[model samples]
Target: MATINNTPAKPEPVLSAFIKAKCPRCRRGDIFASPTYSLSGQKMHETCSHCGLHYEREPGYWYVAMFVSYAFNVAEMVTVAVGTYILTGSNSPWLYVSLLLGIIFLLSPFNYRYSRVALLYWLTPGLNFEPWRSADKPENPQQH
Candidate 1:
């Protein structure tokens, strides 16, 4: 008889899981409570109601989010700089700076939300919420 390994496979990190509009916890949960957005951006819920996963670990923890934000900003600048140079056929300072700033501002909100969520998903590996399956129903539904 051959021995079989029974270890369960580890789940993938949620940060790199999906780019859709869903909470990293229970992919079905909504990150934002309302569809409205302020001058800044969409307001995200403090915690995931479905799985009770907190968005922020601590107040100061968000400071690290700036690093992620910076990386995104730099990438945007590089992309815009290269595109501007290619499109205009000249290395104009005005065009470079203007395009850089424009891309930065345009992508800021997306970067902010993604960075925060990525960090949260990375730090909380144990918060993975598996979806309920109809085929795997409880033996006694009314026991609780």
Candidate 2:
């Protein structure tokens, strides 16, 4: 008789895992407690449900996500401005201002959600996907 391991036969792809907002380490458990556009507002799980990896590495870790959010905002603003100019060719400042403001308002949630996701996925130095953690059952499931 052969023994079966708990690990997944094939691990999930990085991009798919990131888009689904799975835990950076486990890639099986969700990172966010609530949906991106939830009425109650987005909520994040403190730790990975599968592997028990803490979401926040240390105190004030999330503050760094603010800078990530800021970068997202600037990129979004520039894209909107350039796109508006190309499509409308308007010299009016009001048009640009109004469009930019509307865009910022509309995309705030997206920026908020993705900034943190980006931070966990790319910016954090040590955190990386562990294929073994994506198993059907974690070796030890206690929250870290």
For lDDT, the strongest prediction is 2
Where model 1 places Cα greater than 4 Å from the true spot, the runs are: 1-17, 34-40, 123-144
lDDT of 2 by residue, 1-144 (tens): 112674356777889989999988878889999988888999999998888989899999999999999999999999999999999899999999999999999999999988899999999998988766777765544565
Question: What is the model-wide C-alpha lDDT for candidate 1?
Answer: 0.62
In the range 13-110, model 1's lDDT, one tens digit per residue, is: 35434454456655545566543335745787877655555777667878887897888788888887877778888766887777778887777778
lDDT of each: 0.62, 0.87
* Cα-based TM-score, every candidate: 0.68, 0.90
lDDT of model 2 at residue 119?
94
Residue pairs with backbone overlap in model 1: none
